[model samples]
Target: MAFRYLVGRGKDRILVDTGNGNAEYIQAFQSILSTRDLTLSKILVTHLHPAHAGGLDPLSRVTWVSSPTIMKHGHSPRGFPNLTSIKYTSLTDGIIIQTSDGDTTLKVLHTPGHTRDSIVFRLSEEDAIITGDTLVPHDGAASVVLEDPVAYLASLRRLDALFPKLAYPGHGDVVVPATDLIKRSIEEQMQLPERIIEALCSGGGIMDARDMVRRLIADAPEEARRNFTGTVLQHLLELEKRGKVRKRSVPKRVPSAAYEERDPDRIKGPGGLTLAQVSKLVKESRAKDDKVYGLKPVEKSQEKGKDFSGAESGKSGKLERSEVVQLHPAHRELEPLVEVVWSVV
Candidate 1:
């Protein structure tokens, strides 16, 4: 989770990234709001990822503000009300916030690698920067999977020159000696494209995003693979955006489509399957209706690859990295399965 700051004066309060829509997140946010007795004046969403912007659904009464570039997506989670999007708000560098108690300005540094609208807020008074997934204090590698390496590299360099002391990120502890932290983060992120290009240039042989993720971090634990894969997709998408890679070559899935296909309602799973695909899997699992009765894979005798079932029986469904065969759900179960996937996506 990225750390969000509440910077305002007197009675007004600004809520940063609402976190997710889970019980823990909702309770925490409610507690915080109750303690401060603050009604959300402005909700600043750094980007539209679920972990950062998922909580906006509950705070529908507030004015939601986001980069003009991101505003086109409309309010997140789809059905929220009182949504107001502001664009063409030339927030290239520092932006000033006018309040009754003078000015509480924030330096809006648009760092594009993590996401197109990803920004880092710098508070001069505290000498602290709010790095939204761009720089983590520990074990925090820039989310390269779906990021633009070129823009990301530039963003890192800019951060290095701007602040030299400390950084408070979306998650984890604060980073001291900010210059060093920025340098290392940039260096590490810069290598991602090169590595991918190398693997592609070598014998990796036109691997998809998922394959590249597995190859990039072979030694990482299975539990962490999904996250690492997501980060890798961020990089790949950015590369595609830069013309360094081709989008047509990438696999067509539903989850990535929420952003890639420009359809925010759909969610893509980390397994390279789209939300629609996952829903299909779950529907075929129950084998209830005649539609689901014949939901088996097209080829049963083919030993070339594993078949995908709508659902995995027992605890195997919970396994993060497994290649075992499972059952798909019945047609009736499709909607619920999709809902579950969307809740996470």
Candidate 2:
């Protein structure tokens, strides 16, 4: 259910991100073309996701433009049925599109992380940006489904830096003051890692991703649960990279591995917030008048220490704060916090 846009001046028309390849979408697009007196000339895909690229087959005669990264994966031929007639163009950071008369121009911005191939089209003439799922505006808030938390956050910051006057996102109504929405999205994402840490710490020191998802969005509708789970997992992976948390691989008999807080006393997170500060902020955000969601830590079982190692019986092992090494190169700039001493049973 992604939105596709038709941009044109005179007879030169460009289609942005085709919707699902349903016959209805094709008919509707044709009707729009007929009503507007604009012929389909080219397609600009934001990403290679099915809902966004599905209609490419029907419009195969036109020139297609997308991320070079996506093209390497053979999206043009395998994903679209009629690649024989389509002329594929790979775009990077600075590709520009000019109308035949040269009045309107659209610049491509490589903004990956909703997918590795996501891009945004910026129409400076209109002060608008056609953002794919890389940045979405929903209910006066920006939403994102991140494939990589670090990349996604960086992309959001990049969009904010652009200071677009308006945003025509892939889904939802056009957002005014687009930079503000991007900023809000960044703030929300920044808080997610801390929220995950707090959730893990509150749940008797460790919990699997599924358990964290359930606790975080206990009241969310069924459709939203899957997306929330993905967000939780992404944050956990990032936290693990920062050495704020560690993943304990469970035996094959278990469905998922458990994630444990590396340091319960002083949980480090993005923006230098400790666990207590993050918990307070979360509680304040959810508070109504004097009422706030109670963040009581779940009762710790006698087996809490044993569970940390993912073994039935073992003394919990500890690593000196200085000895902890970050495996992810992206987190090299992140400074490890104070000494972490894990208690043994």
Candidate 3:
């Protein structure tokens, strides 16, 4: 939270990001409000994740404010703390919060990265920014949380350009010199493409998302594994945009468990991808209420150097990097270190 005082308008105080819906968590928040003699006038959540918006069911008597993403997906995939109560006021970029005697204002900026609805509150008067999961102190808040590393990179750069003197992240230990921290985070993010190339070069064979994690983020904290996964994926997407990476063409089913065409949602191809022809068959199979199935691909037959899934990488599901392209000039020295080519699915 940027400022406890900025939570509400006038004299009444508001809550930001309801903790969890559990009894212990609810009590902790109540304890704070009671001790402070603060009337809960409103609540503002960054994203509707269980951890951030879970306490809504028990503590959401007051009005709430959040991005439109909240209004669209009321609850997360976990389905805890049904967000059926209290319609939230949708927030957009450049909106101002009238918090005080007409002198104080809190500006909201849509910073989508950690999650689509992730946002930050910029308290210009205080020279501080309340960054939700969008800008955490450690691991950049990546988890099961779906992140668009491309959008994430742009959001981080935006935050860096607006780098304030103080930053309060959604998680992780608090630190000082927030500007420096944001810079370090951006630099780390920018270097991922090269790191990915290095990881692929070292493997020298077909790799999958799991393999990428094992090789690239080997020393990462256990909790941050998902975050690193999203991070690598983000860079991979960017590299694909630059024509440096490509997804492995999915293969035709061979009647195996992993590749059984009859299996629900099973798509097999190069790097374990589902090419267009394969995807069409899957769709057509499900559409047919009848048990009749389409003709299966000849055992081990391929599309003959094709993307089978016809997906633009990251859209049709997990993508594999079949080859690596040089990322930058300064890193050219490492190119020679890559003796063999590789692929990832």
TM-scores for every predicted model: 0.54, 0.66, 0.62
Q: What lDDT tens digits, residue by residue, belong to model 1 across residues 148-167?
A: 55676888898888864788
Off by over 4 Å in 2: 61-87, 139-143, 251-345
Model 3: residues with Cα > 4 Å off, grouped in runs: 1-10, 31-35, 61-82, 139-146, 221-223, 250-345
> How would you encode candidate 2's per-residue C-alpha lDDT over 1-345 as one tens digit per residue?
999887766776677887877887787767777787665555778877767877666665333332111221123222223323344777678778765557678898887667667788899788889997877775321134555778778988988888899999888888898888898888888887777677666654544554465556655654454555555656666676677876443211111122234343375444454544434443333232123334332232333334434445443332111122232222222213211211101
Clash count for each candidate, listed in order shown: 31, 0, 14
Q: Which lDDT tens digits does candidate 3 get at residues 1-345?
A: 222222543455545676666777667666765577655544677766667776666664433232112222232322233454666677678787654345445687888766667777787777787776777766533332445666777888998888698887777655466788888777876777777876655554343343455565555655465445545555666676787766553332212232233342554454454444444543343233122322222132222221233545334332233233232221233333221212533
Worst 10 residues of 3 by lDDT: 66-75
The parts of candidate 1 lying over 4 Å away from their true place are 8-11, 22-40, 62-93, 138-144, 194-215, 222-345
lDDT, candidate 3, at 304: 27
- CA lDDT scores, all candidates in order: 0.51, 0.58, 0.54
* Candidate number with the higher lDDT (2 or 3): 2
Q: Candidate 3 at residue 32, lDDT?
A: 69
